[model samples]
Target: MENEWKIDASESDVLIKSRRSLIDYMSGSKNNFKGHIAIQNNEVENASIEFSLKVNDKDSNSDLKLIDFFENDETPVIQFKSTSFQKVNKSINFLKGNLTIQNITKVVELDAEFIGYRDYNGTKNASFEIIGNINPKDFGLYYNSYSSHNGYAVGSDIKLIANLEFKNQ
Candidate 1:
């Protein structure tokens, strides 16, 4: 599998699967949430990967938004933020006199670090699984009835699925 057109990922290519609840919020709404660099070219090592992964708002569609949080100061310690759909959603009740709560779709970004680098293989592609939250309120979604409940609007969870081909060049 290491012939080189595409490389398969080994156990080491997984990097680390981290759950970052906090990001800029504007930059986490993307499908290609992460990036990778081939550490080997023609079986020789030569590349570094810099990437960021966007958590799922669950929709897996065009109705996604992101917020970005960048580092502004230099410190030996690292700090990150965490948030959920509740931050952007509106609650709706059918009691005749209630605030209109709309659902918000919020895409969160996760942090991943490459654990190690290795050679390439057609069967050795890197795969990632990210977890995050989405709020319909941020996107302004509402339910027609609160009593009926529609049965589907129970939770705000998102997921991301990807098939990556690693090429060492």
Candidate 2:
């Protein structure tokens, strides 16, 4: 049997993390996103997800400097479209996908954990946790020379984390 699931945005959360220094870090989160999963015979056949973060959104916790760093005006959205899923175990999988930032697309792999399913209010729901790391420089999100010279350089790795819930459609 084939089944399709849509993200329950109200129950899902996405977060981003980055290091500003050896001991200092920054983090932000967003609740608004859209995604879907396709399953056949209890296995994920494919999936896709997309979300946008506003550099000036207070709730997003985006640093003011990011306004120019991310070029939010020209490219306001970040998106991910899964190309394949590789199962490593019963509960663990690697989701290979294309991640687009600032109109630049790069292939990335994310660790996905299937947290199983549940019956809630006569509906079937599923949960998952996805994590990935990306280098901001790869997408041209480099800090100015001044920041680097002053030892305020941001770490190359930015972690993307998601706790997602899906409801069967």
- Specify the highest-TM-score model's number: 2
lDDT of 1 by residue, 52-165 (tens): 343323333322222111123121111122231111111110111111112212334443222333345533443322222334344443222224433222233222222234
Clashing pairs counted in every model: 36, 0
Residue by residue across 1-169, what tens digits does model 2's lDDT show?
Answer: 8889998877776666556533111222343567887767777756676555443334433442444456436535567777777877666788888888777899999998877788778888888778998888888776563464454556568777777778899
TM-score per candidate = 0.29, 0.71
Q: What is the lDDT of candidate 1?
A: 0.27
Specify the highest-lDDT model's number.
2
What lDDT does each candidate get? 0.27, 0.68
Worst lDDT window (10 residues) for model 2? 22-31
